[model samples]
Target: MNPALIERLQAVDRQAESMGRGERSAYLKQQAAELGMSLATLYRKLEAVAVKPGRKRRSDAGKSELSLDEAKLISAVLMEAMRRNGKRLMAVRQAVEMLRANGKIEAARIDEETGEVLPLSESTIIRALREYKLHPDQLLQPDPVSRMKSEHPNHCWQIDPSLCVLYYLPRHGKDTGLRVMKEEEFYKNKPKNVVKIEQDRVWRYTGTDHASGTIAVRYYFGGETSANLCDFFIYMMQAKQDTLKDPFRGVPRMVMLDPGSANTSAAFKNLCKSLDVHVQINRPGNPRAKGQVEKANDIVETAFESGLRFTEVNDIDQLNGLAERWMRYYNGTQIHSRHGMTRYQAWNKIKAEQLILPPPADYCRELAVSAPKEAKVSPDLEIRFGGRVYSVKDIKGVLVGQKLLVAKNPWETDGARVATFDADGHETWVAVPQVVFDEMGFRADAAVIGEEYKAPSHTESQQHAKELDKLAMDAETLEQAAAKRKGKAVPFGGELDPYKHQEDTLAARNTLYIERSGQQMDYNRMEVAEQVLSKVEMAKLLKPRIEAAGGDWKQAVALITKQYPDGVAASQLEAVFNQLKTAGRLKLHKTA
Candidate 1:
C-alpha cells in the first residue's frame, strides 16, 4: 500500500468516525467518487490502512502431532518407494497409511473430550514431515555446491565427453561425409537405423582451463570410450605444432572430471599418474564440480557445431580441422565474462614453471594406457625392464629381491621411474637411469678385477644380518664365532625340535590310515561272503516285481522274514522276493 494513499484513507476513517452513522455512508460514497473507486473499495482501503493484530496462534502452533521419529519413519517409507530418478511413486497419504498399518510408525493422539486414542491424520503427518525436513523432496535434493577456483592457467583443467546431437559421419566409399541425424530415420522408433550408425555418431570431448576458460574441443567417432578420452586428453596436453594459432597446450596440475567410466578407467588413470597429474573425480551426478568444461560443451554445440549445418565436411579429420580453427579464433578473440579479458590473454599470464609441457603424442598415448609393471630388484641392485637394466641402488628403501613398480620415464628417453609408497601410502616416483656397459660387457662402474678391488657396500639387510649373527652366535665378530664353532656347533644348542610337531602329526596320520585299512579289509571279507540285505534293500528289489505282479509288498516282506529269520543274503534275497511275488501269495489288498 502507498503511504500517501494510506494516510488519506486514515484521514477519511478519522473524519467518518467524527460523523454520525447516517452521515458516514454518504461521506464514504463521496470519498469513493473523488478517488475514482466504489464505497466498498474505499472501505477496503481503510481496512488495509488500519493496523490489525495477528490471528491468535494455538499453544502448539509449530509442534507436530507426529513425533520426529514417526515423521522419519514416514519419510523412509516414501523415500524407499521413490524411483531412482527421484520421482515419488508413493503418495504421502499412502505412505502414512501403509506405515501405520504395518506398525512401522505410530502417531496416535488421545482425544481430550472423548478420552479415545486417534491416529494422526495424513495432513498432520505431511506437515510434520515438511517441518522436520524429512520429506522426500527435501531429502532427495542435491548437496550444496561450493565454488571452485584455479590459481593459474594449467593449474587445473576440467574435461567432459558428450555425444554430438546434430551430425554423424557417414562413409562415402573410402571417404566420410557429415550427415544430419534426422528424426525420420535416426529416431527412437527407428532403432535399427540408429544402431547401424552407432559407430559413426560423433562424440565431442571438451576441455577448459578452469582459470582462463580456454576451451579445447575434439570430435571422435563412436561414444565416450577410454581410447577417445585418452586421445582428447593427450591432445589437450601436447604442445600444438602451430603455436601461433593455438598456444593453449600444457599438462595441467589437476584434471577435474565426473566419475564417468572413461574418466575413471584404469588406462586413463595410469596415464594421469604417469604424467604426474592429479585426477579429481567429482561425485556421481555432480556435473557442476567441473562446470567450466560442461559449459564449454554447450558453447561448442551452439557456437561451433551450429555452423556445421551450413558447411560441407569430409571425414573426421576435416571436421576436427574446422573445430581447431574455431577454437583458436574464439579463445583468442572473445573476452571471457569472468576475467574481462580474452581467454588466451588470461592464459598467457601463466608463469614459465606453471606451464608444464607434455611428452610427444605417441609417448603420451603409451603413458595413458600403460600400467606400471612390478620388477624385482636384482642382487646387483638393478632391475631389468623392457630388456634394459636400470640401476635402482640410489632409490631409498629399495632392497634386493624387493619388487618395485617400474614405468617408462616420460621426461627421459633411456630412463625409467620406480614407484615406491611412503609411510602414508602415497606413491612416490624415483627416476632410474639405464645401465651402460663398456666394451668389456661389464657395467661402467664395475671395478677392474686385476687393477683394483672395490668391495660392495653393505645393504641394510646385510647390516641387519650381521647384527643377527652377533646375537645368535654370542660373538662380537662373525669370524670369531666361525672359528670358535669349528663347524660343529648345533643351531639353537640342539634344544629346539623344529620338526617335532610335524613328526607327531605324521605318526597320527599313519595310525589313522592303518585303522582305516584294517576296517576296509574286514568289510571286503564280509562282502565276498555275500552281505545280508537290509529291509529297505529287500523292498527296493521287490517293489518293481510286486507292482508288475499286482502283489502286496507287506505280505511279501512277512513271508521273507518268516523264511529267513536273519536277513536274507543280497544274492538270494532277490530270487526269494521274485518267487513270493510270482506265487500270487502277496496280492495287493483291494479297496471295498
Candidate 2:
C-alpha cells in the first residue's frame, strides 16, 4: 500500500473513534466503502498498528534468460551483419543465422537438467536491437520525412545526383590497347579497388518539380562534383524539348537538396542566391524528405539506365542524347501516378504566365559561379589572383601596391575578375584576366593585361574559396610532378639535423600564437606581453640543434631567425637569445 493511502485510512479510523458505538460502526462502513475494501478487511488493516511487509520478488527470476553482456554482443553482431542497408526485421533473422553459424549461441551455458542453450531467438535479437538503439544510418529505416507541399510548379525543386551502374567510354583515356571491361568486372570492383575511380564512375543529376512531379536530368562522364551540379542546374533551367510545347524550365523559388559537399558548397549556394532561389537542405540521414526526386532516381535506375547497358555509350554526349529521348517520353507521354495526368499536362495546367524563366545572359554572367578574395597589387602593376598573375592593360602602373578585390571561379579561374575599391567601398576599376592556355589547356599566365570594367553589386567573399582553389592546384601540380619524380621529399622534422629542432620549436610557437589569437593581457598587472617561447623552453628546443651543429650555437640562432622572414620572431626571441649568450652556452661572435 502507498504511504499516502495508509495515512488517509488512518485518518478515517481516528474520525470513527471520535463517534459513538453505533455512529462508529456506520463511519467504519462508510470509510471501508470509500477505501474500496471489505469492512472486515478494513477492520483487520486498522487493528494492526505496525503492518507486516510482503516479501519482495527477485528482479532476475524470470528475466535472466539472457545476460546483459550476451545480449549486447548479439545486438552488435546484428548491427554489423545488417550494416546500413537492409529490409526491416531482416537484420533480426540475419543476426540469428550469424550467431548460429559462428557457434556463439552454442557456446552459451546450457541448463543443468534440460541441457538447453541460452535464449537466442528472433524476438530476443529484435529486443536487443531496440535496447541498443542503433543510429538511424545503421538501421534499415531512416528518420521520418516531413516536407512542405508546393502550390506551384516553379515554387520548389529537388536536386540530387546518383551514380549510374552502366559503364561508358570517355571522350579520351579509352586507350586502344585496353578493351572495355565487362559489367561483372565493373560491379565487382568497389571505388577503393579501382584506379582513377572518379573517371570510372558516371553520374546522373535530377531536378524534379515539387508541384507537377516533372523531372529534368543530366548525365556526366565523371563522379558528382560542384561543377557537375552547376552545369546540370543550368541544363535544367535552359533545356527545351520539341515533343512537349514549352517544357519545364525555370529558376525555381526554392530548391531542396541533400547536405552533400557539392550541394552545400559556397559556389553552389552563391549560384542559387544569385538566381533568387532559396536553398532548403533535407535533414541528414533522411532522404525521404525529397521523395519525389528519390522516386525519379529509382525510375532512372530501373527504366532509363537499364536500357543504356545494352547499347554502346561511347561518350557523355551519346548518354545525354539517350537520356533526352527518355525524358521526352517521360514528360510528354507517361501519366503521373499521383495527379492522374502526364507531367507536361500537369505543368501546362499552371499556365505559362505563372512560371518564371532564367535571367538574360548579361545578368547571368554577374551571377556566375565565383567567390570574392582580397588581393594587393604587386609592384609589377599586377595582382597574384588564383595563383596566377593578372593586371589591367588599360591602366598599367596605375594602382601598384594598392589593395584590390579579386573574384575567382575555381571552375573557370582563367576568366577571374579583379576590382579596386575607393574610400567609399565602391569599385573604381574592374577587369578580367587575359589568361593564356598552355598546350594541355592549363593556364600559363595572362597573355595581355585585362581591360577595365564596372564591378557588379553581387560580389561577396566566398567561405574558404581560396583554400579550395589552392587544394585543386596542389592536386594538379602533385600529379604532374609525381610522374617525373618517384620519390617524395623529406617532410619537415624528418631530417636528422639541428635545423629540424629549431624548425619544430618555431612551428610550435607559431601554432600557439595562431591558436590563442596573438598576445594575451595580464588583467591584474594591467600589462600586455606577447606570448613568446620562454628562455628555458627556447634552450630546451635548441639543445638538439646546437649538438647537431657540433656545439655551435650560432647555427641554432640562424635557424631560429630564418623562421621570422619579417623579423617579428627575431625581435621576440632577442631576450631569450641574450640570456643564452650571457650563460656562455651561445658565443657572441662580434662582442664590444
Candidate 3:
C-alpha cells in the first residue's frame, strides 16, 4: 500500500524477470515474505499503478505575432478559450498559438548569440501570438521614422569592430594556447578578414565619424587587447592633430566606442587619460546603445563586401592610408540622403547646435578615484599587511597568508576588507568570528585541549612506550587465563560472546596500539585500524610541518618515526615523500 512497500515488490519482480527461469511466482513469494504479506496482497496494490506514455512532441520555431500590441490582441482570444474550457498549461499554449496564426501576424524568431532575426515557423508564431492577444494589422504595417543632424567634421567619431567573415570561418592550426580548435568549436567568419602568417592570425580595426560620414578602417593584424586599442587611439589623435588648420588645434574631446575587447582595455583607459580624452563605457552587450557607430559599420562593411579577399596584409602604414582615403571618399564626396548636399554640407545644418563640453582638465584629474591597496612591507622584510599578491617590486616581510585590501578606490568611504589567496584567487571571508567559530571555543579551562599537550609529547609517549607495552601485555595474558578458567567455553559451539571476547588479554596490545596511535575512533577491525595508522596519508600530513624547517621531506618522515616509533613503515614514508615532491609540495622538517 505504501510507496516503499510497492517498490520492494517491483524490484523483486524485476529481478525474477531477469533470471533464466520463469520465476515470476518465486519473485511474488519472496516479495510477500519480505512485506509479511500474501502474494494476493501485493497484486492488489500494483493494480492501482498506471503505465505512462513515452512519445514526445516536436517544437515549432516561428513567431506568428509581430508587435507587442498585436500579441496582446491575440492573447485575448486565446485567454477566452482557456477560460471557457479550463484547459492545462500545454492546451492553453496550443490554443493561443493557433489563434495567433489565424490572425495572420508577422513576427521573426531571433538567435541570442548572433542577434539575427529570421522568418519563423508559421504554427509556432501563431501559438506565441495568440497567447499575447496580437492583432494582424498592428504587426503587418508600421510607419517611417525621422533622422537627426550632426554639427561638424570630427565632432563625433564612433568606433567598433566586427570579425570579418574570414575571422569567423574555421581554420586549420593550433590555437594560441597551443590547444587544437576543431571546425565546429572555432568561429565562422568571412575567410578574407583574418589573414594568417606562418603561424599567427591578424585582425582589422575600423573607425567612423558621425558628422562627415567618414569611415577609417585599419587592419590590426592581431587579436584584441588594450595595447592594440591604445595604438588605435594614438593613430586617430595624431591624424586629427596633423589635419588641424591654424584655428582648430584642439583634439576630439568626446570619443564614443562600442563595448569590445579592444575598447575596454586598461591600456586604452591609460591612453585616454594622458590625451585628455573622456572615456565612457558603453552599455554592455547592447549594440543599439551605439546606434550611430552601428550604422557606420554597416556602410563600411557594404563598401568592402565586394573586393574583400584573403591577403596577408602585413603593412599597417599602407592599410591606414587606404582607410583614410575611404573615409575621405565617403565623407567629402558621397551625397547625403536627407539633404541634397554632400556630407560636409549636411554637417553644416547642425553646426549652430550648442556645446556640452567637459569641465577644466585639473578638476577631472582631482576627482579621479584611488587605486587598489598595495601590500605593506615591514623593516624586517615581512609583509605587515594581509598577505596577498602585490606588485612585484622590492617586496619585504611578505608571508603566504597575508590579506590585501581590495577597495573600489583608495578614496572610498569604507576601508577595504582583508583578502587572502586560495587556489582560485584572492578572497576575503566577510563573516567575522561571531558567525560560527571563535578562538575561545577551542578551550574550556584556559588550557590548550589536545593541541597543547605539555604533559607528554608524542616523542615522550614513545619513550614510555616499552614500559607501557609490557604492562599491557601482562594484563592481557592475565585476562585470557581468567576467561579460560571460567566455565565459559566457546559459547554454544563457536558462537561469539562479544563481551568476554573484548576481555581477551591478547587484544590488550591492540587496545594500546589504538590509544598510543592517537586515533580516537575504532575502525571496523583491529588489523584494518592498524593498517590505517600504517598508511602514507598520515605520514604525508606530517611532511609539511616538518619540511617548513627545510625541503627535506625525509626529516619530516623521521620526526613522525620518532614520535610514532613502531607505527608506519619506511616504504610508506618514502612513497608519501615522493608524492609530495612530485606534486610540488615541500615536505615539512620537524626537530625531534
Candidate 4:
C-alpha cells in the first residue's frame, strides 16, 4: 500500500474510535468515498494494523538472536549517530552499519540451525519506530490555518500603518518660505533642487473591512504617531469619493490592530472608549490576526505604488491625491478574492442593513482624539497649552495652582477645552477658553480679538484686575512674613497655619470690647485658632500622617522625622497627637 494511503487510513481509524457505532460506520463510508477506496478495501486497510489482545510472539520472529534490551541499545546507538552527524536514520542498512561499527553484532548469538549470525531487517526497525509512534517529519508539520472571519460589513475593521519610499521634488530655500500661494503657483514653480533624487519616505495608514474587503488608505509625510493615526481615521470615516462612494463609512464594531506605538497610545484607547467601540490587539508574535490589512498593504505595494513610478509626485498632498484615486479604483472596480465581487458592491449589498454609522457631529468630536493633559491653573485663572495662554473668566473663588484637565481641539490646536475633576475623578466641563495675545505679543490672560482697538474703560474688568492685584500683594506679604516666622509655622509655608494672621475684619472684632463686658472679656483669637480646625482642613493635614503611621504612634514619629528631617520635639508631637485624638481623627496608644 502507498504510504499516504496507509497514513490516511490510520488517521481515519483513530477518529472513528471516538465516534458512536452508527457514526463510526457512516464516517468510514464517507471517508472511503472521499479517498477513492471501496468500503471493503478501507475496512481491510483498517484491520491490517488493528491492535490484538494477548497475542504471543513467535520464538523466531526476529532472525537476530539479540534480546529486546540489546535491540533497544542498538536503536539508541543508531539515533545518536544520526543526531551527531546531523542526518536522518531512514534505512535499516544504515542502523546495521552503525551497530556493527560499535561492535554490538560481534556479541550477537549465532542462529542455532544455520550456524550464521542473524542480520537486522529494515522492516523490523521501521515497525519498531512505528509501534513507538515516533515521527521523523514532526518538525515539517504546517501551521494550523486561521479561521477568523467577520459576519457582516463593518463588523471588524483592521487598521495598520506602513512606510513606503518614493521620489519627490526637494524644496529650495526660497520655496520653503511661509507663504500662501495659488494652486498653479504652488505646483508649477520649478525648484532649483527639483531633480535632487532624494528618498521620500511616507507613512501610509490603511483600514480594511474584514467581511466586504472594503478599504481606505491615507498618506502622510510624518512617521507613525497618534496625531497621524487620528487624522487618517477621521479621513477614512468621513471623506467621500464619487467613484468609490462611502463603502467604508460606518464605525466598526471592533477594530483589530497590532501592538504598534500609535495604536497602543492612551489617546487611541480614549477615542475608542468615547466612541463605544471595542478594540482588539493581536496576540504578540501573531501578525496574522489582522491579515486583511496586511494583504491590503501587499496590494498597495504591488498595484498602486508600482503604478506611481510613471507619475510626477512633488509633495505629500500630491502623493495622497494619487492614493485616493488608486483606492477608488481598487475598491470600486477590482473583484475581491473571497467575495468574488467588487468590495464596493459587496459592501453596498449589506451596509445599509447591517452597518452602524458614527455618532452625531458633537459626539464625534468628543470621540475624536483630544490628547488630554493635567495642568495647574495660574493665579490669573489661566492655563498654558501648546505655547498659548487660555484664560478662564469669572473664576474668582477657584484656588490657584489647582489641577485642571486640558485637552486640545482634535481638528485644531489654537484653543482647548478645560475641565475640573472632583475627588472621585469625575470631570465636568468648566470653560472653553480663547487664546490670548497682546500689544507686547502673547501676554498672559489677554484675549486676542483680531485687529480691533477700544478706548480704556473703568468697568468691572478694571475693578477685577485691581482686586486680583490686591490679593497678589497680600499673598506676597504673607509669604515674606512666613519666611521670617518659619520656626513657628508649618514645614513648607505658614500659609494655612494658625499663627498666620487672621482676616482683617476678624482681628478687629477680636480687639473690640462690649460695654456689658467692660471687665475685659477680650476674645483672644490666636488661642482660639490654635485649637479649632474645620473638618476639611484638619483631614487635609492629618490624613497623610494617619496613613503613614497605620495607627502606630512610634511608626508615625519615625515617619515624621524621616519626612521632615529637622526633628520634631517629642513634646510637640505628643501635643498634636492628643489634639488629633480629641478631634476623633486618630487614636494614639498611651504606651508610646
Candidate 5:
C-alpha cells in the first residue's frame, strides 16, 4: 500500500511485460524470491497496485424488480400506518408482507438469462421506494414556505396562544399568588394535581406585527377563551398612555391566527368586523402560517417568562404588568433582523391613513357582543338593520333577495358592515353607510321628479331571471316571451291546474252528502245567517261589571231591555256596551 512499494511493483511489472512469456514467468519468480515473498503474493501485490478500467455498468443497473407503481402502493400503506408525528408504525417488511398478502402489489422480475421468475424482496421494495421518492420519510416533511411580507406596519398581524407550563397562579385562602409547577408535584403520575389547578393554569397570548416584528404579550389566568383573546387583542389595538415606553398600537389591516375555537368565535370575529380588521384564520394543522406569533411565544417564554422564576409575582395583574414592561423594552431596543432597525422605528414609518386608531375600550367591548345578523338584500338593493336601511348597490356581486351577514360598524355611528366572501371564499367585512333621506321622506340620491329620470341598473337577479324566463317559456328572450303571452302566460307552460285540490274537495263533499241522504242535496235553499247573543251570554258578559258595580244588576237589565227586547246582536255588543258605560249605567268604583 506504500507509494514506494507501488512504484517498485509497477517497475517490476513493466520489466516483466517486456520479456517473452517463459522469460516473464522466470523474471516474476526471481522478483518474488528477491522480495522474500511467494510468487502468488507478489502477483497479488502487483494486481493491487495496477491501474484497472472502471467497473462496467449494466444496461439496467438503476432499474428495480419492484415497479414504481408497486413501490408507491407499499409506500402509501406505510404512510397510512404512520402517526401524525411522523413516526412510522409499520415497517417496510411489515408493509410489504401485508400488501403482498392483500394482493395489492406484484413486483417481480424474470431473469433474462435463466428465465426464472423472481419476486422482489422487502429490501428491493424499500430501495425502489427511495429511488422513486415515495418513502414516508421523503413525503412527510414540512411543506415548503415562501417568505411573506406586509406593505407597512399594522398591515398584518399574527396572534397565537400557548399554555405556560412553568408556572400557575393558585388561590391561597382568598388571594391568588404565582406558584411554580414543579415536575415532582405535577407530573403524568399526578392527574389530580393537574386537574386541581386547571382553572389556574397560566396562558400566554402573543401577537406580532408581520412587517415590523413588534411583539405584544399578555398573561391570563385561565385557558384560551374568547374573553381573554378579545382582551389581549384590545390591548394590542389600544394606544398606550406612556408613549415613551411603548407606542405600538393600531388596528391592523389583517390578522393571521390559528383556527382555534376561541379565535374563530363569533364575538372575536364581531370585534374584527366592527374595527374593519380582516381576520385571516390559517388552515388547521398549519401553524407555520402564523409562525411569527409562534416564535414570539417562544421568545416570551425564554427571554421574559424564564426570569419569572427568579422574580416575585403576586397575581395575574402583576405578571401582566411585568410582561408589558418587558415587551416595551424589547420592541423599543431590540433591532429586528428583517429590517435591521428597532420595531418602534419600523412601525413609526406607518402613514396616517394606514394607521387606523381603534375605538375606546368600552366601545370595542360593546362591539364584541354585536354578532353578525343575517339580512336579506331587498329588491331595491337595500338591507334593513337597526331600524334603518343601508344601500348595497356599491357592494360588488350583490343581488336582490340575497342574504348577507351584517354587523354594527364601530367607527361609524350609523353605518353597518356587511360580511361578504371573496372569490377565494374568505370572509371580508365591507362598511355600508346608512341611506340618507330628505325632509320629504324620500331618498336624497333620488332623481328629480320631472327634470331628470334615472333608471336603476339591472341586478344579478334580473339577469338570471331573464335567463330563467327563456328556459321556462321556451322563448328567445323576455320580450319575446311577453309578446307571445300578452302578459297572461301561466307558469310551467300553462300545464298546471291551480284549483284541482279545491275541485276534488267539493266533489268528495257532494258524494258524501248524497250517500248519507240517499239523494242530491238542495243547494238553492241553503243559506248562512248571523246569530244574536242569548240572554245568558249577555248576563255572563255583564257579570264582571255587575260585580264591580256592587252587585247592582237593575241598571244593566234596564239598558239591555231598552236596547233590544229580543237579544243583542254580536256585532252591536261592543257599541251597546260602550253606550252603557258612557251612560253611567255600568260605572265601576276604583278601590284604594
Candidate 6:
C-alpha cells in the first residue's frame, strides 16, 4: 500500500529479471545486496511473489490476470496522452516510465519527455494504451498568503491557576473564647476555625493590553476557591469600564484560559457582558496560547517579587501600595524595545496602525467616583504622616485658644495638621518645614544604643540629653526611657493625668488643641508651663484715627521673629496686627 514499498518491489523485479536461469539463490542474494535488505526481507519478498499453488517458483506462479475492463482502463489513459502529444510531454513520459518500471508494460521512447509505450510487451499497459486519456499539458501549484494579526489592546488575554494547597483544622469545644490571652499556656494552643480554606501558591489574573503592552495584574492570596473566583470575576467585570476610553468599546476579544473555576464560570460571562470580552479555553494540558502571560507570571512571582521563595506578606494594603508604585514605574519608565516604547508611551503612540476591535454596542460604561478633596500646603508646612485619626483628652498648651494653620505635608500627604511643633517639644506659632521623614529608630531598637539620640522634637531631645548630662538615671533608667521613646509612640492624655501634669501632657500629645473659654496666658508660657489661648467669640471693630497697616499673620510672625529669643509680648498692640486674614480664607501664592 505504501508507494515506497511498491518502488522497492519494482526494483526487486528489475534485479530478478537480470538473474540467469535456475539462479533463485543468486537472485535473492542480489536483492539482499542491491536493496540493502537483510536475508529475512529478501526471503519474505521471494515468498510473497512465489505464490503458485503451494511452493511453486515465483516465475511459474499463476498471477490473477487483469480483466479486459481493467486493462482497457489503463491503456485508454496512456493512449489518449500519446494521441495528443506523441508521448513528448513530461507527465506522459513519467507515466510511461512508471508503467515500465513496474513491468506493467515495457515502455520505451527516445529519451523524450513523453514516452510512447506500445503494449506489445505487456497486455496490461497495451490495453490501457488502447483507450486511456488525460490532458498532459496542464500544471498546478499553490500560492502563498499572509496571516492576520491582532489590532488593538485587549485583543486577547490569558488566565490560569498555577498552584493549590489544602489544610484541615480539628474541631474544638466552644469554650475557647472563655479564656484570657495571658492565661493561655501558649498562643498556638488556641482553637481556631474548624475548616481552613485551601490556599493556592499564587494564582494570577493578568490582563495584558496587546497593543499597548500594559498589564493589570492581581494575585489570588486568599481562598482561590469558587468563592474567590466569583469575587475576581466581579472585580474584573467592573474593570470593563475603568479600563477603556469608551465603556462601549471592545473587550478582550479572546481569553485564552487554563482549567480553573475562576476562568470557567458563567458568572464571569455575566461580568464580561459589560465589556463583551470572549473566552477561549485552551486544549487540555496545552498552554501555548498563554505562553506570554505565563512567562510574565514567572517574572512577577519569582524574579520580581522575590526569588521563588514565597514569603508571606503582612497585609493587602502594603501589597497594594507596593504594586501601585511598581505599576507607575513600569508603565511610565520601563522601556521595552519589542513594544517600541514603554506601556504608557505605546498607548499614546499607537493610532490607525493598531488593530481595530469593534466594541459591543450594548456594553455598559462605568463612571469613576469623584476624587477626594485635596488640602493645599505651604512648601515648608508641617503635618502628620499617617492615615488614622485619634481621640485625645484636651491638653492645655500653645495650640489652645489661638488660631492655627491646618494643612497637609506636601511630601507625606498622610494626615492634616492642626498646628506645628517647634524644635523643642512645645507647640509654637511657626510654619512647619515638611522635612523628608526617615526616622529609622524604633521604640525598642536595642541597636540604637550609646549614640546621642534625638526624639521627635528638638525640645524633648535637648531635655532628655540634659538629663543624660545630669546623670539622673543610671544605665537602667536610660534603657527604660530609650525603650519607650524609641518605639515611636509619643503617648499622652489617656494614661497621663493632664490636669496634674499639663506641661508634660502637652509635651506628649504631639498636637496642640485650642481652648474656647476666655483666659489670660503668657506669650512663651506654652514652652514654660500650661497655657491655653482663648477664642474671641465676638468683637467690635472701629476705624482708627491714625493711618494703620492691614491684618496679616506672617507680617506679625516675621515682626515677632525680629524679637528673636525674646519676641514682643503676646499682649502688645504692636504684635503686628493680631487679626485673621480677611474673609477667613487663604491665598496660597501670597502665603508662599
What TM-scores do the predictions have? 0.66, 0.43, 0.32, 0.39, 0.71, 0.28
Worst 10 residues of 4 by lDDT: 192-201
State the lDDT of candidate 6 residue by residue for 1-592, as single tens digits: 3677666776666676677766857777776888788878876776565434565578824432334444443445555555432554334445556665776644422324656443333544333333332222221112243443456655665554543112111124432111112323323334342123223123454555555656555556553454445443334334343343312123455666776675665445433422334556666645555666676666555434551123334444445445545555666676866776877676655454333343222222110111112233222222223333311112123221234434332223343334435467543222233333336623232235587564433333345675773353232465665665566534441355547778777788879679789878758545564332222211112112011333443443443344333433334432323332322342212222
Compare candidates 4 and 5 on lDDT and give the better one.
Answer: 5
Using TM-score as the measure, name the better of candidate 3 and candidate 6.
3
Candidate with best lDDT: 5
Task: Name the runs in model 2 displaced over 4 angstroms.
Answer: 1-82, 86-144, 172-181, 188-193, 196-201, 239-246, 309-314, 351-354, 361-366, 372-592
Report how far residue 266 has shifted in candidate 3, in Å. Answer: 2.4
* lDDT comparing candidate 5 with the true structure: 0.85
Q: Per-residue CA lDDT of candidate 2, range 205-249, in tens?
A: 988988889878887856778878877777777737562554778
The residue-level lDDT of candidate 5 at 514 comes to 41
* TM-score-best of 1 and 3: 1
Q: Each model's C-alpha lDDT?
A: 0.84, 0.65, 0.48, 0.64, 0.85, 0.44
Candidate 4 per-residue lDDT, tens place, 1-592, comes to 8888778778888899999999999999999999888999889989986565797999866443445555566556555656533476545566667667887753344567998876646665555444443333332234476688788887888899986544333455534221222344334345533223223335678889888898788876557888777677666656366524655676667788888888888777666544445778887666667878999988887888777666555566777787887877788889988979999888787646565665544445555545567778676667787677777544434456777666654334365666554577654444466655667776654445886654433345566665564353443454554454553544334355555456765877777666574476778565433344433444456566665555655454454444445533433555655554554434554333
Report the lDDT of model 3 for residue 589.
40
> Highest TM-score among the candidates is held by which one?
5
Quote model 5's TM-score. Answer: 0.71
lDDT assessment of candidate 3: 0.48
Per-residue lDDT value at 567 in model 5: 78
* Model 1 Cα shift for residue 363 (angstroms): 2.3
lDDT digits (tens) for residues 349-372 of candidate 1? 999999898998999988876888
In the range 307-360, model 5's lDDT, one tens digit per residue, is: 988877888889988988898889999998879999988988899999898889
Candidate 1 has what TM-score? 0.66
